[model samples]
Target chain A: MERTRAPFAALREALHAAEERTRLPVARLLLLVLLLSVPLWPMVDSRWLRILVLVGIFVVLGLGLNIVVGYAGLLDLGFVAFFATGAYTYAILASPASPALQADLNWWLAIPVVLALGAAVGVMLGLFVLPLRGDYLAIVTLGFGEIIRILLLNVRGLTNGAQGLFNIPRPELGGWVLRSLDQWYWLLVLSAFLIATAVGRMRASRMGRAWEAIREDEDVAAGMGVNTVKYKLMAFAMGASIGSFGGLVFAGFFQFVNPSSFTLAVSINVLSIVVIGGMGSTPGVLFGALILIGLPEVMQFSETERLLSVINPAVPFADTTDWGRQVASARFIVFGVLLVAVMALRPEGLFPARRPQARLPERHESTA
Target chain B: MFWFDQFVNGLTVGSVYALIALGYTLVYGILQMINFAHGEIFMIGAFAGWAVLLLLGGSAIAGPMLIVALLAAMIAAALASSFSAVVIERVAYRRLRNAPRLAPLISAIGVSIALQNVALKLTGGRDRVYPRVFPTGEVGLGDFSVGYIQAFLIGSSVVMMVGLIVFIQRTRTGRAMRAVSEDRATASLMGVDVDRTIVTTFIVGAALAGVAGVLQGLWIPNIRGTMGFLPGIKAFTAAVVGGIGSVPGAMAGGYFLGLSETVGRELLNELPGVSLPNEWRDVIAFSLLVIVLIVRPTGIFGERVSKRA
Candidate 1:
């Protein structure tokens, strides 16, 4: 029995070491390959490109939300306010509303402006909710989100009200207008990748640890010389800025800005992505976005009566009225069910963070 | 005269707000989680009431029969809303009890969306008009006029509020509910059926919301798939403003919110060179929530519970 135990122990130790070695680097390489290969694919269709752009945008939003939710442990139900701020910032600055730019401002200029506006809004929102925590914080943020949406709706002269701001010019670089959906796809992919990497690094840094500490126990974190309030605000601002960045890209890509676009639904979608992706994990956020966005697009056939008819002979797939409404509404139900399932079965997500290894017990202790 | 009109309008609206706020406060007091689906439950009640009115269209039912139908509508709404609440607790929240606080919260949002969509599908995404079952006669006193529908709304809301208060203070079930809200494990140890109490709390709150929904349909004369959204949100704001987890606080908060919205709109319109449109009423309500949170996170009457260890 002792001889057999030695081999089993050796094998187990070897497997554990192998897993520890390959886990992060392999994941990084795979992500790198996926990112690099997407741009080189020659047969990428417009529809596929559009899907990619959406995935990238949501990935960024999810990452930003992860900062507040996963790191700071703040339940911000109104994260879309930052997204709106970014989109509106780009719209008002680049569109005809601004006499100085007049649709002539470079995309680069608008990007920074959007980011700044997003950060500014994030800081303001953070300051506003500095004293509140938990459920109260959630409601207050929710109210703020509605307030922003209402402002956008009511301030017709500035926002063009429900009609929305349109005719947004595409990103131009040195007289080259990148108007194709594929070009925008590449831009979004690059931006999402950069933001994800930065967020991942941030999670590993001092501030990230502070956030985790605060999340686990606020009083303990504060007692341990950590500035709880500062770290919390940092998480909020960073998340908000990232969300706004995604919004800026989304606005430019769609060439439209409207109050309807930045609803509570958008905020919920981003939150779900983070939750499904596994809180506090960067690659998890990307994976979550891809699944949430890409799966529906790929499975668009499942929604069609013709496809369903072929699959099932007994059930009639025809006579389904309001296909558009059903399609729109189905997303929420599917997301909700998935969220519940994930929380029940795998709260840690598909790929959980690796825990630090502990040394084997000393021989004396084992023998005793 | 206009000021008096605005004040009366505010008071009437405030009463409705108090009704809705009671539901939020009651649920929050028990679970310590803001039932995001509470608003959706309120929406369900409105739709249920609308359905009842539709069924009784053109019927020559006298006073007692009309009261029966209204009671039936309230019962239907309460049943539907309670079922929804229970289902949400079982499907989305039960398993999440030991998980992070955010887990239940996010799940609640998911449930909220799911319920809203289900409601949208059921209601066909259109405004379902309530059949004009109630008379629109007006009662006048010293140049002041109150419509029958308005009077019904205010009177019924006040009665409901009083009944709810009495139930909480006097009933054994209500005592169990209060105990559970105070401390779940202790309440259970003390022989209170925590789960049963929770279900009962939800049923009671939903019944009140159901009544409010019917009254709203009669008073406002329109019911849409999304009609409950604004009212639900306003009521929640009222609950918070009054003092979440406090029964009396909810009543006070609801009336305050209703009054604020009504008076703010009227006063804004009357202000020279500062005309505010009616749609901005929601903005004002939400802003009030933000300002309240900034000033007093525990709300006006809510006592702070120590953070969970």
Candidate 2:
């Protein structure tokens, strides 16, 4: 009797190649769907448009965070600090209510300043925690975030303390001041698309490879001549800059900026988006933002209220007329449960990024 | 006299921080992951204690009955917190043992948020007021005075710390815990039930946090669902300052932070042009954490953490 192998290795390799071939088209199709939705923005209800805008903003934030947490593997529980920095920077420059540093600045000029400031803040925080690793870095970053919030609350002379900044002027493109939901929606969509494209390119660059190495094993990456410190700082700066952009838009949309608005919750929300969206996957981020941010906003509809009440009449409601608000308030609980469930059941996330494949040397016919 | 009063206050606060820090240290020792939800366990403990106190007549109960009620509350709180911690370990942490480091942390944060919101929903987002049970008065020794509750807090904290030290040094489970922390794979190979040991670690830490929660309620006289957040952060600071994963270091760190916030703040204010606000205490604590990490990443009593931790 003779024994023979089934050529399992070659079969697996072929299957993987097929998967890689199929994934690109699916990703492109998802992007196409997203881009095709642009014209429908004006057709949707203003209320729904507002929610979509919010979703777009978070999509940008999620992509930014993916750079650090996904590509770099740094668990930054204090990413909100950068968000607050951007918001405050914009509010102080553009808001008339800014007590001490009111510049009555133009939003166009403020964009560069806010982003640069955001990157600087990121670099500063990055430097402080460079010596730390893993959980220590996380805790330290969290502390840094709290310190910023507390400073905002206490720095009465400059920030107007807990009163916050209000009456921020709407962003302007040339002579037209953007105020309507559709206008902001267009701006957000454009920015989201630009950011997505840039990020996608970055993910394939040498820097992205370095980040991937650092994330996998920092010491080993350093041993392999990957300048871990420089790359980590670059990740922080990049993530922070994009997060600040989210903050800038948030201020413009609401015409308000408060320390309370930029709490740990915001960081958690962005992080949840990145984690749930599939880390390094752009399409996954878009999907994540829709579920985490968009779903909650849509839950505020009266239809959702009716849907809920029919499901369980015993559901506790702080306000009967606005039952949707009550359910929306409990979204954090849902977020929590979803986080645990996702991590335990599918750590790779629902829309995981395609892992980079290493090409093997060609097999000789003699080997068969 | 003012300094003495501050000292007493520091001691009382420090005691609570120490107890919570112990839980952090113990868990970190074995698992090397910060149990971010540990603070919520402490809050649950307080709620459990509050429930018992309410059942036992709350503020109305007096004399010998007060002592019994207090004991019951402490025990109940411990059980509740231990239960919560065990479940968190099983549900949130157990499976992520070999997963990426970030997965368990994210799960823990999720648990923290969920537990906090659930507690908030349960309590109608209102503070659960603890009935004032201890008689109002200060025990004095020639201008150095301490409140009855403060004294109890200090005394019990010391007792627990001593008992824990003894247990860790002498008991079989304690030895297993130490062994697991030292080298988990080797310890398991040596026949230690790694899963059970991890669960025990969580239970012990949570029990201490639970007890501290009740003690904190007695002192503050009110407990809220959100009460655990700040204390949890502070206790983690204490754990880190004392060189995390070291029990004795945790105790030292807690007292150090407590004293610095109170007495140390006062001392700083004595400097020219220094009128520090009360809130600056938090800033000070965090700054201290940053400084320590920069200067001595291993903490005061922490061993060489460059290798594993």
Candidate achieving the largest lDDT: 2
Q: Which stretches of candidate 1 lie over 4 Å from their true place?
A: A1-26, A35-44, A97-103, A296-305, A313-329, A348-368, B57-64, B269-272, B305-309
TM-score of each: 0.89, 0.91
How do the residues B1-309 of candidate 2 rate in per-residue lDDT, one tens digit apiece?
899999988888888888999999999888888888988988999999999999999889899999999999999999999999999999989998887566677788889989998889878899999999978887888788888999999999899899999999999999999999999999999999999999999999999999999999999988988889889989988988888889999999999889888898899999999988998888778888888887888777876564321
TM-score of chain A of 1: 0.82
The residue ranges of model 2 lying beyond 4 angstroms of the native Cα positions read A1-44, A313-329, A356-368, B306-309
Which lDDT value does model 2 have at B278?
93
RMSD, one per candidate, in order: 4.6, 5.2
Give me the displacement of residue A323 in model 1, in angstroms: 10
Residue pairs with clashing backbones, model 1: B14-B255, B17-B254, B18-B254
| Per-residue lDDT of model 1, residues B84-192, tens digit only | 7778778887777677565676677767766776666676777777777786677877669777878778888888888888899899998998899989999999999
DockQ of each: 0.53, 0.50
